[model samples]
Target: MAQHDDDRRFSLRHLLGLVSRFARMAAFGALASVAHAQDAVSTPAGPSIALFYGANPPIDELARFDVVVVEPDARFDPRAHPKTHPAWFAYVSVGEVNPHRSYFSAMPRTWLPGVNEAWASHVVDQTAPEWPAFFVDKVIAPLWKKGYRGFFLDTLDSYQLIAKTDTARAAQEAGMIRVIRAIKSRYPKARLIFNRGFEILPQVHDLAYVVAFESLYRGWDASKQAYTEVPQADRDWLLGKAATIREQYRLPVLSIDYCDPADTACGPATAARIASDGIVPYVTDGDLATVGVGPAGQP
Candidate 1:
């Protein structure tokens, strides 16, 4: 009888232990679900207003938005600028040579194929392994020292404009991916934003915090010096692609449309359209010389 009683006791204790373990696991699962729900709820509904390629606004003005993208050499004191919840990012041209910079003179002229002279920026051979080191030393480090929080890497798709063949394009894309990965590894905490590099976004998406598309809905006609709406087909294609990135990668999409600031209606209309697609939008002039706060009381 005593033997049977001992067996019953052992069995009961084992059952109790199993029930306790399962209860603990269930509690943990519930807590994890709540945490994930909170994260989703906290995600920003829209991107904060941002400025790119312009003179720095006064400290008070700059504090109005959530981010500021500007040229690396732009004269501004980031440290002295009051924290307006804005994260300042310096611009770095990834695949183009700006003649205005003395550093371009040091780079071999051979690197530039001179295919597109529209922007007065020469497209460089991204496949060249030496470019990454130069960019880190001259661009990334300097911006970091200036107290900038991150980088706005541009011209990533310039190679596609100049590439003559599929093989050449693939090589250029691979090179860009390598350089972006290197930069991410070097500065893990820095926020990196790529401009209109949708072709290579899949490969480097993990390394980037945001992707910006310039001239999305509207583009500037350099010859006419007027704003023109993009074709419906192009708009549809871009919106579809942006949706995929946002859904699959969970990265915020930022849209920049060029328009005449004097046309008051353009800014609000563009912002509403972009926000409807769940993307952040900024309407600015072609040169990006002036700042547009977007309709009054809107950020």
Candidate 2:
């Protein structure tokens, strides 16, 4: 696991070559979302991290670690997490709205999903200029006001998938940028972090407080209740993005590679190798929804 820290400097250029291959995937929109790190954000001593799936983090397991990553729904109250854990993140996706969220009902039909691929999770229209602002004002601001340390932005690729026009793409990009700007402008001290931002890394990295490179290699399938193989392209893509984010963006990173809650996804050996890729890895279900009472999250 320690090898990634030692070899990252060497792999920087090699990974950028891989990024060139899948850049076309930007059809969704060429935008990235990032939350910048604040003074409060730091590498945990021995840097052990605790990751939780629900609105509330398992503080009992977290107290022993330097950091905790928890999902933040509108229902979540950041004040509920322990004060002793200096690094805390509010898990929210600026790219898409979950069908279960309170505000999903307020979305207009025009802003709904264009396709249902990649698990039928709801996708939104980032082309709308005000949409990102709504997320900032309504969701982000509320979390910040609650005294949360930072954000964990999931599904950033959704915007690129939904927007069809260059204009839509531009607006979509602006929307993500606006979300970051709004937060930094209001709370300069607050850290903003993003997850798995391969397609939009060029536009988004500068604003991030941290870069979360998810599933850099093979992981588990929660739905199938088994371990699964992450595509070589996907793995290469994440590796390249990680290299870019680290070298060009100069950002700290964490790897959330879900090996299934079942633990049968990747063997312990592979899981260890995932951590060696210059990230603080996690083993969770990668839950994307909050209000929906269901089995765990993503598989």
The residue ranges of model 2 lying beyond 4 angstroms of the native Cα positions read 1-49, 74-76, 113-119, 164-170, 220-225, 260-268, 286-299
**Cα lDDT of model 2 by residue, 1-299, tens digit:** 68986588558766776676567455323443112232122221124444576644445555555555566653556566546654777778777776777677777768775654556567766666677667777777777887786777777767777777888777777766666677677777876667765556677666677777556665546566555667999888777776677677777666655544445534344445554555544555546222111111111
Best by TM-score: 1
Candidate 1, residue 200: Cα displacement in angstroms equals 1.4
Local distance difference test values of all predictions, in order: 0.77, 0.61
Write candidate 1's Cα lDDT for 48-131 as tens digits: 757657666654655567777776666876777644667878888888978887588878777787655677789988888787
